[model samples]
Target: MKGRNSIQFRIITGLLLILLLSVGVSIYLTTANQKSNLLDASQRTLAVNNEMLNTTIRNIMLSGEAPIANRTMEDFRKITGFLEFELYRTDGSTAFNDYDTLNFVNDYQSMVMFDQTPRVEGRSIDTEDFQQVLMNKTPVISLNEDTREMEYYFPILNFAECRVCHGDDEFIRGVSHFRISLDSIYDQVRRAGVLMAVYFVSVGVILFTWILLLMHRTIIKPVLDIGETVNIAATGNLDIQVDLDRNDEVGELAGRVNHMISGLRERRDLELQNKVIETRLEENRKYLDHIKEGLLLLNSERRITGQYSVFLTKLFMREDIAGLSLADFIYPDAERFADERRDLDGFLEMLFTNKTADMDMIMSINPLNEAVLQLDQDNEIIIRADFLRIVENGEMENVMVIFENLTDIVHSRHELEEERQRRESELEQIATVLKMGPKVFEGFIEEGERAFGSLRGNLTNFSDKEFISEAFRSVHSVKGTARYLDFPGVEEHCHQLENLFAEVRDGSRKVDKSLEETVAGTLDSLDDELVLIRKLIDRFKEFSVGSESTQVSPFNVFGERINDMVKDISNELDKDVVFNLETDLESVPGLPEIQPSIFHLIRNALDHGLEDIYERLAAGKPSESQLSLRFIHEDNWLKIEVEDDGRGLDMPALEKKGVEMGLLKPGVHLPSQIVNVLFRPGFSSRDEATSISGRGVGLDAVKEDIKKMGGRINIRTSRGKGTTFVLLVPWKGDEEGVLV
Candidate 1:
């Protein structure tokens, strides 16, 4: 049963089917050709017999013997395979009907002997072959399948001898019709087909048997033997070998099988030796698991080898670290560590490909050294990786990486650095507080609270120019004081608030919920700073000689404060300025409330309105630019002015900047309208901002403070002369130099 289903059996079955098909096609073609030849011979013989009958019939008609012609046609019809033999006249009428032509001739002879008119009725025949022969004057042959016969109508031409009796009006005298049976020709074809079939069957049987025997001897027997040996070898018996002994393909296949069997024996011996080596390797793996450090191997492809120390799994907090590339295992976040990953891939390529390269020099630029990795969410560790060249037979092979965990040491160093920074901050704050004194510090804290409250209030409505300016100025005032007092934390917080307002002013940032939230958050931070300063002041109070009642008056040192500020600002701006101070309201009411305005106006005049030293000389003015501050009380209004002999307002530049800042339409504007824009929030002509005046908030804040006091300012300027701001404030004072 197995041999029947084998390859040899299938191959022989397919070939046998092909052979049978070829034999069937050959028999069909030969039989058809033979039938065709037999039909041609039969047709030719029938045609020759028709010609002989025509000659015989013609001679009988010329003899004027109807009996002879009728008797001759009867004899031809009685011949085997000749069904009908008759003569047709030119008008498709038969020359004789039932021996009627003989009778008619006798009657006509009698009439002629009696000297009377002779007439005889003839039989007419209607047939396609007869009509065709009469009209065309040619022979017509047709097959009648129903009768298994062929009909031939041969035209008897009107010869010269026949034409003597017939008229010269027609070319054909009559047609000779013959109907012959085709059954005999078909019988001969059937017999010949049977003989050919027998011959083909015999040849096919002999060839099939011979080919099958040859194939079975040469291919099937040897292949079956080889298959049996292979099955035995598959069952773990490698001693079996094929015994086919020849020089053909089968013999070559058997030899290959024998060679394969020998190789299997050698493989069996090698596998036995490998089992011992595997046992030793298992022992080495157990030793590696006990090692403290993380150790792994990387092949030339940069993929981690299967064998690695067990510490890697614990260090990475995962178990599937083996067989991963160095990039995937160490720097798993591809986008975040793209540079480092590229470096690692290049380093690995160089290390594996360049065998003669310096290992130490390459190791110096290793990207993985002191690398930080996040193992899982919320768990990160720092590792210092070191690579060792793993050499095999004086050639570079795998790389051995040793990872040292440095997470704890790094965290300890960070904590120490933060501690050092905190101490330095505390020392600086102490020095600033000691220089400014507790009273001024306390006042500043109180003032910061009020400024923050105002800023927060204005944050609700940025479109109100007064509110926006108020918010801006509050922050600027706090920043200026904080800087003078060397309170860096408070100063930085104010600076951040200034930036937020500046963005809103210039139309770069919108006045939305986000802006309000950011401003509120920054103000809250400032509040926290104030709380911290309060704590520091309370501590200082505990160690001071004077108590809280020993407060200094701001009016007594007002001039000194203004002079110091001007000196500092001019030196910083690299400008030469001659400052003049005139005041008749020393004991004025609310001096401290408007102190920030004065300071802002001074800073603005020096920073924004003044040019450098070279501009003063080129403008035909004294190199020492003039700046003046005045205060006068008259008619219940205190008048104050801050003047600068520097460049006045450039209206065209201001208008252009206003359009760019989205504060004005892009067209002509009045100079007064343009000047009013100076007090609008965040409208600065300066492209970049500095610590001084580019923030576009100082004038806004100054205007906001003056508005709160029901006061107004007036500006006067010329092209190259100077610009002056005169501030008018309401004063309601009573007798005895006291407030009402």
Candidate 2:
């Protein structure tokens, strides 16, 4: 903190100042060291030279003691400059002088042995250190005062050369003394300081410039380029790119940034396109589902080929329909109905050949009833397929599949055929009944003859009442028939007989024996004719009751129609259904036609035939209950089933429950017979329902009313298993299918 004497600042400041000060001091110290060394060296040289010269000069000046030696002294002096040499005798004199200032007095005293002074002109010394040599030999060293210039003391020492001259006084004689001026050497040391200053300033400037230039080239340029690219990117200009002209860390960073921007742009555009495509696809799907006809698409292998909505899914029932093997999802019988193998092969061939294609395919499907598998009765399944092939994205591809339901049209044809057959049969029966009517008249004539004969012959055990009773019965029959037909002759005959019987009861005697016989005979004759008429009438009534029914209840008409369906059909192919009739289960109070629907269902079961006995037996079922017609009252519904042990309906074949299929209306659950394809226009399960299915109009009509009544129909079977028809019909019908 403090300096002891001359320094003027605090230690911290002072030390820095001192360091600055030391810079020059270092230079001064170096100069001083050189100067001191030179001075000491030069002083020693001068002393030695001066001591020899002092003696030599003394000998030469003492006047020719030896000529040759005197000459040598002059030569030595010339070489030495004779600058500080002096000789002072014991008497005090300048023995030889090369200069006017040569000292023989106090000057010598000023030149100490190692100390040289310019003012000490010629000082000499004789000391105890050189005493012996000084006393015996030539002057080794002399001590004298330099009075001319200054008082100087000289100190001397012995030298070997001087000791040679004074053997006994070697110490003193060998000593020599001289003083040499050292001022000139000081000038050389000062000159060196100037050269060091030049090197320090010049080299420092050059080195500093070189280092800074290197820093700019290596570090600053890369930084500026990074800043420019960042600014461009901030403006959302992803196209701006940086080309760092090097394979270095910075170059890799630039590449990463460019890659990130490219990806973002690509993904954004892709997302937008995907959104639009998805929206349109959803709309198109809805439009397809809205159509009346069911539509489906299948791949080359007959598997469902694409994604569809839940509504579209109704076209096929199972979830695994799409992308599965055709056999896995479709009912087993469906494989045959659709002719799947042929269709699949054709489709694949068309695709591979790259040709446009279209075809109409007929498939057998039990669109309505599921229970009976008679193609003639409820199990008839027929479908029309329309197909097309097209190219997509430059690749041969299958186009859309559109399905149209043709069942109703086919069913209409069946009904027409049934009606024709029914009309013909009725006409035949009418002809037979009419012919029998005449036969009654001929029989009456013969009976009259017999009656008269009976009167003459005497009869026994006869009650008069019995005769009247017999007569009354015969007369009553004729009268009733005559009244019914409005027959004039027959009614008159009936009146006469009644009158005769009345008189007899009153006991009239005018009715004589011959007269009584004739009257009795006439009555008897009429009775015989009436008997014949009755026989004919009996046959006619039998025919009429079963035909052209006046009561068209849904069940009766449906039953009749179905009976026609199984005409000539077999017991093996179509066994009768033992109906589970629910007697207490009444139709809604207002709908009297429900019974007809129930009856038709049983008929449908029979026509379709129980599945084959073999199939039924294998399935652990009775081949006959065979057709099981059940009607159970449910919650507001009459859940009925008209099932058979026959094969199940092939749904894919009869895809559309059409008019030919006996569909009364849309969304209706018809009777089992109408629901089955067995009732198709020309379809007849003659082979299958050997006993029941012959006429084709079985289920086609029944299903119509059932559906209108708000019911559902389902068919189930394994190919070898029996078929079952399940109906869920409202207890109260919609009347749409009901007859007036």
Q: Pick by lDDT: which candidate is best?
A: 1
Each prediction's RMSD over C-alphas, in Å, is: 11.3, 36.2
Each model's backbone clash number:
0, 96
The TM-score leader among the candidates is 1
Question: Residues 75-115, candidate 2, lDDT per residue (tens digit)?
Answer: 55465323333334332333333333334322543443222
In model 2, which regions exceed 4 Å deviation?
1-276, 288-292, 299-302, 309-312, 315-320, 325-383, 405-413, 431-740
Please give each candidate's TM-score.
0.54, 0.22
**Backbone clashes in model 1, listed as residue pairs:** none
Residue 382 accuracy (lDDT) in model 1: 93
The lDDT of model 2 is: 0.47
